[model samples]
Target chain A: MADHAAHALEPNPTARAFCLTSAFWFAVATTAGLWAAGYLIAPDFMANIAYLQFGRLRPIHVNLVLFGFVTPGLLAAAFYYVPRLTRTELFSQRLGVLTAWLWNLTVTVGIVSLSLGFSQGREYAELVWPVDMLVVLVFALVGVNLIMTVHRRREPVLYVSIWYVFAAVVLTALTYALGNVIWRPDTGALLGIPDAILLWFYGHNIFGLLLTPLSLGVAYYVIPIVTRNPLYSHTLSLLGFWSLLVVYTHIGTHHLLQVPVPTWLKVVAIVDSIAMVIPVMAFLINIWYTARGKLGEIHADIAGKFIFTGTIWYFFVSIQGSVMALPQVQRITHFNNWTVGHAHIGVLGFAGMIALGGMYFILPKLSGKPLYSRFLADLQYWLVLIGITGFLVILTTVGLIQGNAWFNGETVYRVLPEIHLYYVLRLSAGLAILSGAYIGLYNMVRTLFFNPGVQA
Target chain B: MIQRMTPTAVILGAVAILSAVVFVVIIWPNTTVDMTPSEIFRERTAEEAAGRKLYIANGCVYCHSQSIRAFDWGHGATRIAQAGDYVQDEPILLGSARTGVDLSQEGGEHPDDWHMAHFINPRWTRPNSIMPPFEHLGMENLRLLTRYIQSLGMQAADKRMQRQAFWKQASTKAYEAGIEANVRWLSETVPQGWRDIPTPYAASDYSLARGRMIYQGFCIGCHGPVGDGMGDAQPHIYPPPLNFTILKGRGISGGLIYYQVMNGITGTAMPYFKKELESQKIWDVGNFIAAYFIDELDANGPPRGIDAAYEP
Candidate 1:
C-alpha cells in the first residue's frame, strides 16, 4: 500500500482546505440558484435590488457552480490522489495551501464585483479583467504544483488518472487565458461576431476542458480502487482521452448555429458534436465494465454510489448534447430553457455528482478517519437526485412548450403565462437541491474538523 | 507494446492540440467574418453607449437576446440578424436565452413615454410580463437606456422613429383640438373599407366572458379595470390611455377599434397584438370594450355577415 511512516504522518493541508472550500461554496451557489429561480416565478420577490436582479443572479449562480463549487471539489480529490499515486509527497504543500486560499479570495472578489455591476457582460466570461487574471493565475499555479509533483515521482509510468489531471490543469490554463481574452484588458473581448465565436468557444470548454477532465480523473482513480478491480482496458482509456480532446475543442460554434456565424463553422460544430459519442462511450464502457457485477460494493460505499450514478447521467447528457446540436432539433431547443436543462444535466448531475463523490471518497483518507456520518451523506444524495430529476423533467417540458409556441408565432410574452406553472414546479425542485447543498456542507464540515469517527 | 506516457508528454501534447484547434476555430474566423457595417448599422452616441453598459451590468442579455433568427415571428423579426450589424458591439451581446423577446428591432417600436412606464415596472405596461422592474436604475438612467433601446435597429430604427415622431405630433394636436376633433382623427385614420365593417361575431355572453379574460391579460395594465385610461401606467404615458366613455356619443365602430388594435396606435403605448392575439381574440376584446366601457355595441349591426354555425 506504500504506507510509509513519513506518508502516514503527512497532513495534506491543501486537500483539507479545498474540501472545506468546495462544501462551503456548494451551499452558497445553490442558495444563489434558488434566489434566481424565485425571480423567475415571482419577479417582484426581491424587486429593484440591482445586484439581486435575475440577470445578475443567474450569472452568479453559474460562475459559482463552475468555479467555486464543482472545480474545487474535483481538485480536492486530485490534490490527494496525485501525490499518493506518484509514490511521493506533494512537491510543496505550502504552495498548494496558498493556491486554495487564493482560489477562495478570487471567488469572493467575483461575487462582490458582480453584485456591484462591474461585469464585463459576457456570459461565462463576465468576471471583468482583473478577476479574469486571477482565474488564469490560479490555473497556472495548480498546473505548476501538479506538474512538479509528477516530475519528482518515484513511479515511472503515469497512470491514466495522472494523465487526465495533467491535461485538465495545463490545458485549462492555456484555454482560460485565450478564452477570457486576457490580452484585451479593457473590454476583455474581441469585436462583434468574432467575439461571440470566441466567447462560446471558451464557455463550452470551461466544461469540456476543465470540469470534464478533472471529474474523469477522479472517476478513473476512485472507481477501480473502490470496486477492487483493475481497469477493463488500457486501449479504451487511451482512445477516450485522445478523442475527448480532439472532438470537444471545436464544437463551441454549435451555440451560434442559429445565429449569423459562418455556415462552415456550424457544420464543424454539428459533425464533431455528434462524433462526441466516441469519447463518451469509451470512457463509460471502461468505467462501467471495471465495476461490472459489483453493484453491492458500489452500494456499500457512498462515494461509489454517487460516481456510478454520475456515469449514468454522463450517458444521458452526452447523447442529449449530440442530438441537440442537430439543426432540426435545435430549431426547437435553442434559446430556450431546454438548453438550461441540458446544462444542469451536464454540470450538476454529471460533473457535480462526481465532484461530491470524489471529495467524499478522499475525505476519510486525508483525515486518517472514517466518515462523520453515512446517513447524512445518503440523505444529501437523495435530495440532490430528486432535485435534479425534477429540474430535468420540468425544464424540458417548459422548453418544449416555449419552442412550439414561438414556432407557431406566439410572442414571448404570450408564452409566459403558459409556463408559469412549470416555473413554480422548477422552484420546488430548486428547493430540494438547495437543501441538499446545505446538508452536504454540514456533513463535510463535521467530517473534516469535528468528527469523532475512529481512525481507520 | 505498452505506450508509456510521461507528465511532460501529456501536458505538451494537449497544449499543442489546443493551439492547433484555436488557430483553425477562433483565429481563422477572426480574420474572415466580414466586419463591414450592415444597411441598418450605425455608431452609438456616448449616452447610448453608457446605456449599453447598464444593460450589460444588469445582465439583461440573459433574458433578452439581441440576435434575431430567420424564423422569428415577434418584434425585430422583419430583418434577420446580420454579421455586419454587430460590427461595433464589443463582447457581442448575442445572448443565449430568450426569457424575454429579442430587442434587435426594438427601436422606435414605442415612444419615450411607453418605455418610461415599462422600465419603472414592466407589469405596468405589460400585464403578464415576467421581466424584472428596472426602476432601480432610476429616471435619468432610464432615459439613457431608452435612447439605446430606441436605437436598436439602427437605420431601421431611425425610420420607425421618424414615423413615430410625425404621428406623435399629429396625435397630440388632435387630442388638444377638443373631443370632437380627436374622435374624428382616430376614426378617419382607418381606411374607408374598415371604418364601417361590423364585427363578424355577435356579442354573446360567452364572447363577453372571453373578452373580459383577454382584456385583463392584455389591456387592463394600460387601460385600467374600468376602461377610464387611469391604469397604473397612465401617469407615465403622454396623451394618456383613451377614456372609452368619451366614444359613446361619437359613433365608434367595431371596425375602427379592431383595426386600431390589430395595427396599434404606433406613437402610443398600445403595441400591435396581431403577432400575439388572433383575429377572434382581437374582436372579442374590442366587443368587450364597447359594451363594458363605452356602453355601445356594434357586433351584428347593419351589413353584418352571415352567422357562423357556432354562433348561439
Candidate 2:
C-alpha cells in the first residue's frame, strides 16, 4: 500500500478527467435509480411531474449507469494501465482527454433527451439517434487511442488485460451501431422480433462484451499487482478470454425466451448462457489462485478489498445468470422483478463494484497522491454492498411472489397488494446506494483536484 | 493460448467471432419473423398511431404487456401471441411485465368510458392498481391513448368494438323508453334457467363487506357510489351505466343481477366481472346490490342447502 504513497509525479490529466467523469455520473445514475425505486413505492409520489416520472427516470438510470458511471470508471483504469503495461506513454493523452470530454457530453445529452421524453424507447438502446452517434464516435476515439497504444507496445506478449481493453472498445462500437440500427434513425429498430433480438444482443453484450471484459481486465491487472503475485496461469487467462468472446455474444436472446423468437436462436441463447460458466469460472479460479496466500495483503489494500469482493459478486451474479437463462427457470423468472434483481446483481454488484475498485486502484497513481481518505472509500464500499445486497433480496423475493402467484392464476392487480411492502423495502435500500454515490463523488473530486493527502 | 498470437490476430479474431454471433443470433432471425400480417393484425388508424407515440413517450409499456401466450394464465389465456400479430408494429410494444393487465385482447373488455375513468385514476377501476394516473396527458391525449389501447388486438379488437357499438344503440333505445322497459331489457337478456336460479349466498355482513370491496374495485368507476348510474365514466359511455334504482318494485331477482354482473351488460359501460371477481364475489355483490339499491333481497328465498362461504 505504501508503494503507491511513495510516488511523486505530475498528474495524468486524461485519467483524472475520466475518474472525475465517472465519479460525477455515479451520483447522477444512482439518484435516478432512487427516483425510479421511489415510484415503485408510490406511483403518485411524483405522478404530476412529467420530467421526474418513472418511465423517463428508468431509461435515464439505466443509460447513465451503463455509460456515465460504470463504463467510464472502468475506462479510467484502462487508460492508466494500458500505457503502463505497454511500457510507453499513452499514444495520445490529448485525444484521450478529448474523448473523455465528448463522452461526458454524450451522456449529458442522452440523459437530458431521455428526461424530456425524446428517447427512442428501446430498453438500453433508448438514446435517440444523435446521442447514439455520439456514443459510437466516443467508442471509436477510444478505439484509436487504445489500439494505437497496443500497436506501440514494447513487450511482444500482449497481456490478457490489454486484449480485453481493445476488444471492449472495438466490439462496443460495432455492437452499438448494429443494436441501435443507426442506418434508419427514424425508429432505431428493424422490424418486430428482429428488433427485440438485435436490441437484446446489444443489451446483454453491453454487459458481457463491454462491462464484463473491462471489469475482468481491471481484476486481472489489479489482483496480481495488489497481491504481489504473477498471474496464476496465463494459459487459463487466455482460455477465459476466448471463451467469453465466443459464448457471451449470442446469449442476449436469453432475454426473449418468453417471446416468440426462433426456437433455434433461443436454444443457442440458453445453451450459451449456461456455457458462460466456463469463462466465469476460469477467470475466478485464476484470480482466486493468484491471491491464494495473499488474503491479508488484499484486505490491507482498499483497492484489492473492492476488486476481490467484486470477483465474489461476479461469481454469484454469473451463476444466477446461467440459472435464470434456462427455459424452465425462466417460466418463473422472465418478465418480472427477478430479471430486474439479476440486473442489479450483475451491473451494480459485480461490474459497478469492480469499476469503483479500478478507479480507486488507479486514482493514487493517476493523481500522484494517496487516496484523499481511505476511510471514506471503505465507507462507500460498505454502503454500496449493503444497498445492492438488500436490493437483490427484496427484488428476488418480490419476483418469486409475483411469478408464483400469477402462475397460480391470480390477477396482476391482485398481486400488487401482496408485494407492495417489498417496494417500500427496495426504496429504503436505494437510499444507501444514493448516499454511496454522493460519497464516491466527493472522494473522487477531492482525490483529483484538491487532495490534502501526501503526494509522495 | 494467445501468447503466440499477433495484435492483428487478437483484434481481427475477436471482431470476426462477434460478427458470426450477431449474424447467427440477430440478423438471421430477421428472415424468420413472418412479416406478412396475421388475420388479426391490421394497420393502426391515424388517431391510434398518434396515441401509440404517446404510449411510448409516456412509457406505458413499462408495466403493461401487449402479448398473451398460450402458456400464460394472464389476460385470461387469450389468443396466444402470434408473430404476425405484430407485423404492422414498427417497434413492437410487447412489454414484459404484467404490471397491469395484458392489453392484447383488452379492446372491448370495457367500454371507452371505463378506460377514461381508469386512465384519469387507475384506482377508480382497480383499487389496488399501482399504475400512476395519466390525467396529466389531458383529455385529448387520453382519448388518443384509449384508441391505441382499443386497437391492441387489432382486427379482433374491431370486432369486439363493433359488437359494443351495436349493443350501445339497442340499449340506448331501451333506456330512453322508460324504467319498465329498461329493466325488462336488462333482465330479459339472462337465459331462462339462469333467471329462475336464486343467488346461493345470504347477505351476511361478511358477504356485503366483500361485495362492497368488489364493487369499489370493479364497479364504482361506472356504477357510481350510490349505484345511480352516474359514475365518472357516464359521459364517455354511450348508453351509460345502469341505474340500480330502476330495478326496485320490478321483481328483480338475484339471478338477474348475478348474470348481468358476471357476463356484463353489453353496449353499456358495464364490464364482465367473471375474469376479475370470483364466484362468491359475484353472488355477494349481486346480493349487496339487491339488498341496498334495488330495495329487495330474494337470495335467501330458496335452495339453501349449501351455505356460500366459498361458492364454486
Candidate 3:
C-alpha cells in the first residue's frame, strides 16, 4: 500500500478536468431523472411545457446519464491509472484535457438539441447527427492519447486494466458509428424492422462494450491496490475479457425477443444471454477472491466500499438480466417498469456505483490532498444505496401488478390508477438519489479545488 | 499465452469479433429480412407524413407503442404486428414502454375532435391518464399530429374512419334536429331485444359506490360529475356529451344504457369501454346513471331475472 501511494507529485490536469465533468453531470442527470419521475406521479403538475414534457425529458435524462455522468467518471480514474500501470507519464495532457472539453461540449449540445425536440428517435442513440459526430470525434481523441501513452510505456507486459480501457474506447467508437448509421446523416437510421434490430444491437452494447468494461477496469485496478493483494488469477481475467466480448456482442437481440425479428436470431440471443454467466462469474470470482478476508480493509476505504458494493450489484443485475431474457419470464417483464428497475440496477447500481468509486479513488491522488470530507462521501454512499434498492423493490412490484393485469386482459388505462401509489413511492425514493448527486458534486468540487486539508 | 497479450492484439481482436457479430446480427439481417408491405399497409398522405415528423420530434413514441403483439389484450390487439407492416417506417416506432395504451390501431378509435381534446390535455378525456399534454404544440400542430395518429393502422384505420364519418353525420343530423329526436335516435339504434330488457341489479349502496369509483375514472372526464354532460372536454367535442337528465320520462332502459357505454357511440367523442370495463362494472355504472340522473328506477322491478348467487 505504501508503494502504491508513492506516486508522482506533479498535478494531473486531465484527470482533474474529467473528475469535475463527471461530478457536474451526475448532478444534472439525476435532477433530470427526478423531474421526469415527478411527471409520472402528476402529469399535469407543470403541464403544457413542450420541452419539459415526459417524452422529451426521458431521453435527456437517459443520454446525460450514459454519456455525461457515468462514462466521464470511469474515464477520470482511467486517466490516472493507465499511465501508472504502463510506468510512464501520459503522452499528452494537453490532448487529454482538450478531449475532456470536447466531451462537455458534446454533452451540452446533446441536451439542448434533445430538449428542443431534435432527437434521432432511437434509445441510447438519440443524439442528432452533428452531436453524434462530436461523440465519435471525442472518443477518437481519447483513444489516440491512451494508445500513444501505451506506445511510450517502459513496461513490456500490459496489465489487465490497460486491456479493458483500450477496448472500451475503441470498441465504443466503432459501435456508435454503426448504430447511429453515421453514413446516413439525414435520418441516422435504417428503414423498418431492420432499424429496430440495429438500434437495440447498439443500445445493449452501450453497456456491454462501454460501461461494463470501463467499470471493470476501475475495479480491477482499485480492488487489488486497496486490498494489498495481487490479482487472484490472470487466467480468469483472460477468460472474462474474451468471453464478455464474444457473448455480449451478439445477445442484443434478446431485447427483440417478443418483436417480429426472426426466430433464429431470438434463439441465439436467448442462448447467449444465458451463456453470460461464464464471463460474469469469471470476473466476479477474480475480483472477490482478490479481496477475500480483507472486508475490513475494503470498508475502511470509502472507494473500496463503493466499488465492492458495485460488484454485488453486478452479480444481482446479471442474474436478473439472464432470467429476463427467457421467453417465459419476458412475457411478464418486457415493456414495463420491471425492465426499468433492471436498468436502474445495472446502470445506477452497477456501473454508476463503480464510476463514483473510481472518481473518489483518484481525487486525492491527483490533487495530492486527502478528500474534503470523508463523512459526506459515506453519506452519499448510503443515500445512493437506499435510493437504488428502493427503486428495485418499488418498481418491480409495480411492474408485476401491470404485467399481471395486462395479461389478465385489463386495459392499460384501467391499470393506471392502481399503479399511481407506486409512482409516488418511486418519486420519494428518487429524492434520495437526487440529494446524493448534489452532495457528491459538492464533495468532488471541494476536493478538487477548495480543500483546506493538508497535502499528503 | 493469453497473459502475453499485446495492445495491438487486444484492439485488433475486439474489432475483428465485433465485425463478425455485426455481419451476422445487423448487416446480414438488414439484407435478408423481407420488406414486403402487409395487407393493411398503405402509403401515408403528405399531411400524415408531416405529422409523423412532429410525432418523432415530440417523442410521443416513448409512451405509446406502435407495435401490437399476439398476446396483448389492450388497444390494437385486433391485429398482431408484422415486420411487413413497418416497411416504410424510417426508424420503427415500436416503443419499449407502455406508459399509455398501444396506438397501433388507434387511428379510428375516436373522431378527430377526441384526439384534439386529448392532445390538448389527455385528462380532459381520460382523467386517469398520466401522459403529458401536448397543448404547447399549438392547434395547427395538434391537427397534424391527429392526422398522423389517425393514419396509424393504414388501410384498416381508413375503414374505421369511414364508419366513423358515416355515423358522425347521422348523429350530428339527429342532434341538430332536436333533443327529442336525438334521444329517439339513440334508443332506436339499440337492438329491439336490448331496449326491452330492464335493469337487473338493484342500485344497492355498495353497487353505487363501486359505480361512483368507475365513473370518476372513466366517465367524469366527459360525462361530468353530476351526469350533466358539462365535463371539461365538452367545449371541444361536437354533438357534445349527452345530458343524462334528458333521458328521464323518455323511456330510457338499463339495457340501452349498458349497450351505449359498452360499445361507445362512434363518430362522436364517445369511446367504447368494452376493452376497459367488465360486465359487472358496466352494469353497476349503468344502474347508477339510471337511478341518479334519469330518476327512473326500473331496477329490481317486475319481470326481473333470477337473482345472482351473490346478491341478497
DockQ of 2: 0.60
What tens-digit string does per-residue lDDT give for candidate 3 at A339-383?
999999999999999999999998888877888999999999999
The CAPRI classification for model 3 reads as medium
Runs off by more than 4 Å, candidate 3: A6-10, B73-76
Best-matching candidate per lDDT: 3
Model 3 per-residue lDDT at A415: 89
Best candidate according to TM-score:
3
Q: TM-score for every candidate vs. truth? A: 0.98, 0.95, 0.99
How does residue B275 of candidate 3 score in lDDT?
A: 83
lDDT of 1 by residue, A132-170 (tens): 889989988988898899899888878888888888888
What does the lDDT read for residue A243 in candidate 3? 96
For residue A48, give model 2's deviation from the true position in Å.
2.6
Real interface contacts reproduced by model 2, as a fraction: 0.55
Query: Which pairs of residues collide in model 2?
Result: none
